[model samples]
Target: MFDLAEIIDIPPFSLDRQKKGELFTRALSDLTQYHQQNCHEYNQILQLLGGSKNSFSSIEDIPFIPVRLFKEYELLSVDQAEVIKTMTSSGTTGQSVSKIFLDKYTSTNQTKVLTKLVSSFTGKKRLPMLVIDTKAVLKDRNLFSARGAGILGFSMLGYDVTYALDERMELDWEQINAFIQKHKNEQILLFGFTFMIWEHFYKPLQSKGLQLPFENSILIHGGGWKKLIDEAVDNETYKKRIFEVTGIERIFNYYGMVEQTGSIFMECESGYLHSSIFSDVIIRDYKDFRSLGFGEQGLIQLVSLLPQSYPGHSILTEDIGELLGEDNCSCGRLGKYFKVHGRIKNAEIRGCSDTYAEGKK
Candidate 1:
């Protein structure tokens, strides 16, 4: 079994493109055997792809498990006894989905992954992070949530700057003001989903004649911007508005999903989200699986080397992005980095109902 900590840590795996390719080759071989031993669905997928234990030589050559596989089966490459935590996607009413079967190794490793990504972007071992909810995570003992755990894990590491605001949601004015006011002399790091931060925090601050401490501050937001597409906030417009409010010259956005536990793509000062050596982002042509080149946007496919608890080492996702090559980013980081255009919301499939599925695929 691969020890999750050895390969990934706070700085995030930083091999050059050549070494990264080698790492993926090894992961491809190991994950193929692990999947055959534990997951049945991918076994069928492997057979279809003409893949075997020896067939995979590179990460790009490996077969990709669809993101929808979480809705189909347990899909873990580990024993049931080792299972620890299952993170879920927030489904609408009557529909909730979960990615099951995480062992202690997987859980702790997830914390490390998130920690590394967050720290790298902010350059703060403990940033005064402002979260949307302050108490919901600490109070909810009955429900074990992966998303919540992921956020709380990062927040706990830093200064506990999170607080409550509304009845169901938390927006602590004092804490927010205090963090901003104190951090005015330093770089501030703000974390949340894109829509949530824009709607709840940034928009309200604008109305109240407030702005973030610019310059050293960096905003890290995840989840798809599908909701904001119809709301008419283009990336430039959104960034400009945020700049006006926060006065922060640097803004960073990330692209990631729960399935690939190892790495995250972070936007640098150059304004391109760069992939770590531990993962590969494929800009697919439409829904077709074959890889697409730069300047073209299509379905985003992720080939990750970071799944020990499950067979998500290589998975395809519904997001879209364009590839910025090794020479593109002004920041010195290597490997592929792409900007997300938006999520494919119209890709929702109907009539196919599953208990684990929170929404239409």
Candidate 2:
């Protein structure tokens, strides 16, 4: 029995598409049946959708549940006693949030895969960390909203970590200036949710006419682009504005949901999001669910080998995106690259971001 979960921690993190394809096919096929056999609800959906009940050869053959199902049901393959934590997605304006149960193995694997992904982008050595969100987000140990989970997950990559926002969710200028002065002229790592980085950190500093000289910093931000789009801030504008305000230019925007945390797609300088080895992305036509060719925008179906405790390994998300190409990026990274075009219209608006991006208090 090939345990599909093994690949997430397997060695040789080098870029290899041939190896990735074989591993991805088998792992996804095995995980599909694993969830089907253990999670009755998932199996029922598979049968309902006419999905393969056995190993799959094509990634398109994998059946996926709509991400919203997590909020409506507790779908777990592991026994109750095995659950070590329950993570919740960030709540939208009025919609219910997803509650994902995580066992020790699943949680540990998620962290490990995330570590690999981050290390690939921001070198192996840990750097001085500056988080753009307030310190209060980490209070909940059991239930992690998206922002809370993000802070905790990335906090593992750095030492002497400092929060950039204060209790009021406002920029902590005194603390930030002090921290910058303390770590001046050193490589630094920064993490934050997208909206908060713009609204809370970038805007305040820009308005007050202050600059940090973080030319040696690398920032990783994701989540809640809906809010950014609301403000007419495209990725280019966002990056340009940030560069004007601060000297930092090494910024990478990633795309992920609480449903599939470990299998994130991060941006490279080529301006496309690259799929990691542990996961693959497919764009499906809205009506027939068939795979669309490159540059064709459609719904994003994400497949991962990371979720063993919950039936979240493969999910049909509400986001619209297009797979750009494979192994041909200017940044010199391997694997398929893609672009997200925000969420599908009329999908329930829910994310772990503040409403402030829409000009609301």
Predicted structure with the largest TM-score when compared to the true one: 2
Write model 2 residue lDDT over 307-345, tens digit each, in one string.
999999889999899988877777777788899887888
Tens-place lDDT per residue, model 1, 101-160, is: 678776666666667766776664676666654455554533445446546655654675
- The lowest-lDDT stretch of 10 consecutive residues in candidate 2 is 352-361
Candidate 2: residue pairs that collide: none
lDDT of 2: 0.83
Q: What would the TM-scores of all predictions be?
A: 0.85, 0.95
> What is the alpha-carbon lDDT of model 1 when measured against the actual structure?
0.65
Each candidate: how many clashes?
A: 5, 0
Question: Residue 273 in model 1: shift from native, Å?
Answer: 1.4
